[model samples]
Target chain A: MNTESYLDSIRRGLRGAMESDERVYLIGEDLLDPYGGAFKVSKGLSTEFPKRVLTTPISESAITGLATGMAIRGLRPVVEIMFGDFLTLCTDQLVNSATKFPLMYRDKVRVPLVLRTPMGGGRGYGPTHSQSIEKMFLGVPGLTVVSPSLAHDPGTLLKRTILESERPVLWVEYKSLYPKQLLNGGDELRIWQVEGEDGYPLAVVENFSGSDPDVVVIAYGGASVPLFESMRRLIPEEIRVRGLLPSRLDTRTKTPWWFSEITGREPIIVAEHGTRGFTWGSEIAAELNLTFFGRLVAPVRRLADADNVVPAGRGLEREVLLNEEQLIKAIVESIT
Target chain B: MILIRYVEQSLLRLYAQGLMGGTVHTCIGQEGCAVGVVSAIDRQRDMLFSNHRGHGHYLAYCGDIHGLIAEIMGLPIGVCGGMGGSQHIQRENFYTNGIQGAGVPIAVGMGLAERFKGTGAVSLAFLGDGTFGEGAVYEAMNLAALWSAPTLFVVEHNGYAQSTPSSLQHAGDLSRRAEPFGIPVTRTEGADVIAVFEVANRLLGQIRAGKGPRLLFLDTHRFAPHSKGDDFRDREELERINRECDPIQRLAAQIGADTYEQVRKAAEIEVDIVLQELGVQ
Candidate 1:
């Protein structure tokens, strides 16, 4: 019965990292006491470690550069870029300087810099505030992009990103999932190897009712919410369904062997948080098609947000973002 | 001044002969600012961040002529393993970047780190007049002053930001912009190495003493174009300014003719040996 909210998990993880390592510290705008952070994930941390939590000016470019300089000088700096959209302002430092130093220096120096930001839509923050543009930085080498899904605890992943990672890591947190508590929370969120029991870092839950599954659903981050809910309502009494969740998107560490585990006539459905074209879901679908080419099944279908700006109103937002209805439709259509 | 002048002049010759890759921003008339500020600091303890026209700063701080030449020539044994050209060279405690006003805030971060670790070290960011127009510079200065971070921001005001003059790029006085942030500001006329050094030494001492951040605006002029293939300066005006404020000539005049010749000869021989060792023709 051990349960923790996603936001609380991140706070605990940050506190743990800062407490354990003297070199680890947090730097961002409005990260001090009283105003923990924009999302309040850094709540109470400033009070605990007064000297460690640094409140900075509204300069994402310099914030990133400062983190890079500190990392090179042997300090682990975790920079919080208030919103994911402002990550554009930090591209120069992130791409040219932070990502290049360790490799360019031939490992003589290490840039253990972590940039955490709130991404994804559903809160009606409009175009500038809400975004899931992790796909844009997918091609950047020497940078690791990780997303925490409902299946995995955010705290465990964040702690690993801070203490274990040797390169630059962009930890993307979804705003919608912040309030929800982990369903089956326990020690199940421990740091497992990439090639661990599941063959991936994803914390998957198999909810098959019958013997064989009619279709397999794969999703990540906030998008997995509707996928899980739709799978519950859409699966007929005769038909069975399986679910796969991925916490990390970069795939730089290890490739998921999910394709080999699920076979036969079961169709594959991939869902993602960002736009439909050239997204993380598409990447998974391509990998599935390549590995399971001879398997007898329908084409892998992908469900994602519409290719337009996330509108402000709730009705328009629902129309654009993936809903339970769309997931159910995709799941039902995949088997047919 | 002699070392920077020799490296820049030799690099200029190599650049003209097409032995170097990419654009080179030579600090021909602004050697005084680089040499002066670098000489005033404890190079082993203090960290430096440089902009595009950073060969002078690199030589003045690290004194690795062979490594710099190798990096410019794109050799395998370069400072950044030949990955970074002239614009980006990192070694020891010295780091350089080609982007404008990007490393200023980073210097502030290092300053914060130094204070946190109680290392008694200061971080210096070397920029050009071009960077004064950047919003990040003001942001960095504000943060540095607010947190009392030990950082020195040096603006080598050689008049032009690329081809555009400072009047076209910046408004009001540069030092006044920082005074509002409660950061101490210093404006010294460049071309006198000793003068730049004295002011830099004083400011660095204050910063090391935890007196917040300081800005030093060293006024000088560029003898060469901003970068490769950008000739837009008035030739007569340039000739007049170069004659009046040639830092090398100014320093040589102060040191006597015999010592000046010996220093120039030594610089040329040292550069020749470095270039020869790098197998650069």
Candidate 2:
């Protein structure tokens, strides 16, 4: 049986959303027929929905502002930013314009725009192309940031963001996860999905035997692949590990629903593909520290890339980025 | 033009009395651009986006004198429920924001949406001469022309961009800025309401007829300070502009003295009544 890749899932989701809603439009640079897109996630889409899928010039600011206007005027526009790094060009439109419209206009209008772009660093594309910069948009009031991983169906999350969300969403897609296969529950490891308050899905993976986990690792997006690998490898070593992979990273200050499932005494590791410092892991660690204060055996540890810029060399890039070995080591150290 | 003049003049008085807070960018001398261009568009179907100096545009499009007063006064009964103050106002198809050159791309998108939805409605965006410095405006124009979006760009050249003169802000002729984008450009003396209305009507007609985007440049002057008491121009220059480019005075000359007095008094009384009802006076 042919298994669907993460990229295939996202493309199918885009196609399904456009086919179902006449108001949904796929707009970006180089999204035309024959070229598809830079990452090919939009491959063959323009050919299928010739008029709805539009290729725009390399003007990120105008493209984002145009999409905001379209969303304001009752059309659902999904803008593809070529690469996640280019999102800096769209900051003004997203931060000042899109987020301000609803409240600034006193709830008279809604800007339902979805800006999807690929982020992450394992490919040695140099510093500019591979950084996970979604952290910059985490605290924006009206913007919803979500990064789907291999443990979940990115296509479904993207479709929901396009069709259901009334606020502007920054959908971060990891370049590394695009080629990976979707996780299907097996006997050795079982996977289950939980929905967030805003209807975003979170994938939970644990051993099929259902014994209480020795430790819990919370991660999302590109970090999930290594996390799953580490969990599987630790099974033979007799270490029980439960993983919480959330597609939606912006939970605000609220703790995850599965936070109560884990014993406060067990060490919790918040892993991400983004570089260290004020980041998604840092925020989660803060929340965990606040909620489970005095009850935990050890403080919440964060696993992420080094603070240095991602280098172009494969070996240098791997050294800076998180890998299965690093996660395994962290997990082993935390439990022992 | 008379209503906008009286409304802004009353706002200036209230602002001086310290009853209204924040800065009010009035279109006192440049009322012709607001009245002429706004009157030409289909208010029910067409979309309008205005910039920082947008009080006159808001009044012309909706004539909500009480709503405008209440909005600027920070009342819940205002058009934006006191949330937008003066720089931002929303009434039906009319929208305003304080940012310069940012509304152009939004207007293009709105124009494209109308065209795609088969509405046959044109989106009109208003900007000042100083807004030419913003790169987003050029980007929006390029996309609008390339995609054949039904958008009309209105440039209100009011001499100064909040104290900085246009000569210092722009290098070349502002009227021909849109030429490279292949958008047809037109220029008009903003003090003549009839001329502005005629040109705007023609350009908007072309846009609505699927002729893509057109640019209407208005050579205008603002009688009031950029916001409040920020004018640094020479006294003689200000007086000369006031005498030559006052839309209200020009319109009064067109009509007889008696008719002008009657219309002017009526507009004055209308503004007075609204201010009285709002209890701001």
Q: Which candidate number maximizes lDDT? A: 2
Please report the candidate that would top TM-score against the real structure: 2
Please give, for residues A81-199, the per-residue lDDT of candidate 1 as tens digits.
Answer: 99888899888888888887777763356889999998888999888887789888886888888887777777877886798777899888888889987657243222222334322
TM-score of chain A of each: 0.92, 0.96
Off by over 4 Å in 1: A185-200, A209-212, A235-238, A253-265, A293-296
Question: Once model 1 is optimally superposed onto the true structure by TM-score, how far is the C-alpha of residue A214 displaced, in angstroms?
Answer: 2.4
- Cα-based lDDT at residue B92, candidate 1: 80
Cand. 2 TM to true fold: 0.97
> A259-309, model 2: which lDDT tens digit per residue?
655677678998998888999899888888888889888989889998888
True contacts kept of each: 0.59, 0.68
Clashing pairs in 1: none
Q: List iRMS (one decimal) for every candidate.
A: 1.8, 1.1
lDDT of each: 0.82, 0.89
How well does model 1 score by local distance difference test? 0.82
